[model samples]
Target: MAVTGISANRLELLSIADAVAREKNIDREIVIDAIEEAIQKGAKSRYGAHHDIRAKIDHKTGELSLTRHTTIVADDWEPEDELEEFNDSAMVRLRDALKRDPEAEIGKEYIEVLPPFEFGRVQTQMARQVVTGKVREAERANQYEEFKDRVGEIVNGTVKRVEYGNTIVDLGRGEGIMRRDQSIPREVFNVGDRVRTYIYDVRPEAKGPQVMLSRAHPGFMAKLFSQEVPEVYDGVIEIRAAARDAGSRAKMAVLSNDSSIDPVGACVGMRGSRVQAVVAELQGEKIDIIPWVDDEPTFIVNALAPAEVSKVVLDEDADRVEVVVPDDQLSLAIGRRGQNVRLASQLTGWQIDIITEAQDSERRQKEFAERTGLFQEALDVDETIAQLLVTEGFATVEDLAYVEAYEVAEIEGFDEDTAEELQTRAREFLERQATELDNKRKALGVEDGVLEIEGVTPQMAVALGEGGVKTIEDLADLATDEIRGGHEIRGGERVKLAGVLESFNLSQEAAELLILRARVAAGWIDASELPQPEPEPEPEFEDVEGEDAFAREYDDAEGEVEAVEPEGDTDEPQDA
Candidate 1:
């Protein structure tokens, strides 16, 4: 009866391992390894903690073996940690092992088989904990591997539970959490409810792999469209960009490779059937599917549909676009709380400023009057002459001072002597202005070294001094945004922070260059470390005809082409 019981227990151990592996969806070998470790720990607790106990189970015979290993070591061998005392039970000195075996050597391990014994309550508990911990670790690892690459894919799951407005989803193989912010506004779920979500991220944590799910992600809309539109799935159409305002509104820009198939129409389906399905899934969030184009200005115009745009001026340096709409369309273009413009900006990756035609016209008139006054005051020219200069695109006294005399003389009603007189007056006025600015800068306690940096003008030096930057070191310490202007969140609202050189309208690259030069002047960096300008490629000449010839030749010589002179000069001051 004793022999039969022992055999039955050994078979039962293997059967338990198989059941656990099957239930955990892990490999049988892993469960077997975990069991071996558990048995080894139990043996160590029973035989004495100092003994090197090991356990193994036969794969086919369902047989268990336990042993105590004594490793032979040289006399000089010591414990790895200085504070740890030598473990004499598990280790034998080489000299001591030679007494029992003549051919004893270092690293020779002698093993003594241990008889199987019944487990006590404490031992059974420890074994269970060890097996459970190892199996849990394996399950977590398996879950991570299964879901890591599934990011950006829409998945179906059942709602496992809701904690503090976060939904825990059961994805069969793993669990995913959809935080409140990631779900559609006002969307609620109960336990066991089927839910569809997008897997945006999978992060491994100590507790387990965190499967992050979302219904409001821009990618969620895109994936839904792909599922509904056959052309999008088969690569006939591509969704280039998508943006969402959760339950309120969304926008998607798509492109069609096949000209016969309209990308927007295909996504909309027959009589809006396809889009309706998506809207249902998103809890009635309005979606606008616009056809994407390579031309950024045209694409932005399409993005702001139902609102007529009069003009769009893109400032590529700042990644910003100023859109002018009809006065009546202002509310529509900006949408409720600026939603329309905001979504368009996100889709196009540009900061958008929307204004009515009246606003734009007013701003233009203000600029023209300012420029005309500047010329009139600086060059001692009459109002008519200043208006003429402003209409002719002479923005400042500096433009007339450095321009070719012939170019100025070529203006209607202006002769060579008149151009010469204007040019002389401009140069003299600029000299006086520079002297005044230099005096102002010095009065503000601006160090003379600040003016030594390349690209720093006397006016800029004065501006810097007024902004509390008086020395090269002070300028070097400023970030590009501090010098170029940016938006900052202050008191829970975004406020525009004026830059020191905001009036100068410096480009981002120009601001960085100024800081870099200041750093070099302050001895913070070697001058040689400054970036070198890339050599311009030689211009390829092609045969040009008619009006383009002169402009092309001038552009090739000057490395920049001047703006075309407006047709029919008028006293009303044509727009520049």
Candidate 2:
């Protein structure tokens, strides 16, 4: 198995390729290709470069063969001028090819076996480098293919290196990285320590496959629970949603397919054995297992466990929930640093506002007073009648005027006749108010363009006219927040131009809709243009450098203010 005049053994070449393939976890064929390419390079160095030379190795016998190949051209294949342009290295005349092979025909190839050449130290070193480079490239391709489909699965690896708070893990077949922010709070790893992480992402880069692993990800806990709980793994129970404040606490919602088996109880295991195993792996992060309910309010109540909810008012249009807890349970519902409600919000996919029963009652009282005053002033009704209307949840004159007679009659202390009379008074009062506002709007020189816009009531038009927003274009120029809450100026003074629509008690959502319609009317935006919700920015954890290395991973107040309708009638109108 040795080549003449060469110090390296041919059999040893195959052995080396096998060893490298095993160590690098690449295919043996890839290593063989590298070896053949390196041999071809060495042979080319010995022979002339102009000759077409190739090398092949026997898969089992480890025998190497080197040969030169030339294309056979027919003697009468082309005109004399065309033949003259053909290069000698690429083609041989049929008559000349027949000397080597009497049976040579047109389009056939002439092969000449060449004796193996001796390799010098420099040439051998160069060949080794070529083989190494090719094998390294093959290794990278193998690594990328192996882990690409494994994203979102948990992988166990040993810490191979740590640089600048980033840990590189040797996963046996591939390497992964856990970035500083992706690691759990206050968690640390030294070289050779076993680490378990979630394969969050896998990206192909110039260097190699970048396997992004995470310990802080919510999916990581889900995977851990799947491993510990056989019910979860077997699909008897499904994890509907999960939220984690890594190393601090987590919440998971599970649903059971079998009615007899409780999802929460299955996840909790017998006497907390299963969840405890997951907790130990997560460094003692507290977990709350909740049964998943189809009803949103019930699901939300389950998410905010251990906190008794007195009432839940859902604003479905805005994807928000106003939760009222018993006065003593308010602090528990909110949790320390607002963690409980924040996790519940994340799990439920709804923004939540937690208030005590006392606070809710007070708010309701204030709303009742505001509506009572509006009815008293608008319909010239007494305080008793106004209070009765407010108690029945008639928040606007429009609601009373347009509601079914039976709906109003169902109110206490009101018959069908009284309901009809109240509706008449409500409609008449609204008509007179609209006429007065129209007169004021005309006197203020409000343009017809502003008046024609939908959502701009006559009263709103007068307010806009007073604020110098006399045209649709002027109204369209305002920002969404500006229309919702007028911005404050220097020295605590506020600009009132944007407050024109706010005076009508429009929700932020309604105000934005009004401005959008105005923009459409002014030809600034098309009617087909729809508003898209902005993506929430990822929270940045503050790195606290100390013995603990504590990282604060959650924000105190994470909920965004959504557009909520006014709870009472619009405030009493000012003199036009």
> Highest lDDT among the candidates is held by which one?
1
Model 1: worst 10 consecutive residues (lDDT sum): 567-576
The backbone clash count of each candidate, in order, is: 0, 0
Prediction RMSDs, each to the true structure? 6.5, 12.7
- Runs of candidate 2 with Cα error greater than 4 angstroms are 1-22, 28-134, 405-421, 432-576
Which one is best on TM-score?
1
Model 1 lDDT tens row, 396-443:
788889999999999999999999999999999989988999999999
lDDT of every predicted structure (CA atoms)? 0.85, 0.81
On a 0 to 1 TM-score scale, where does candidate 1 land against the true structure? 0.86
Which segments of candidate 1 are over 4 A away from where they belong?
1-8, 72-86, 92-102, 443-445, 480-513, 526-576
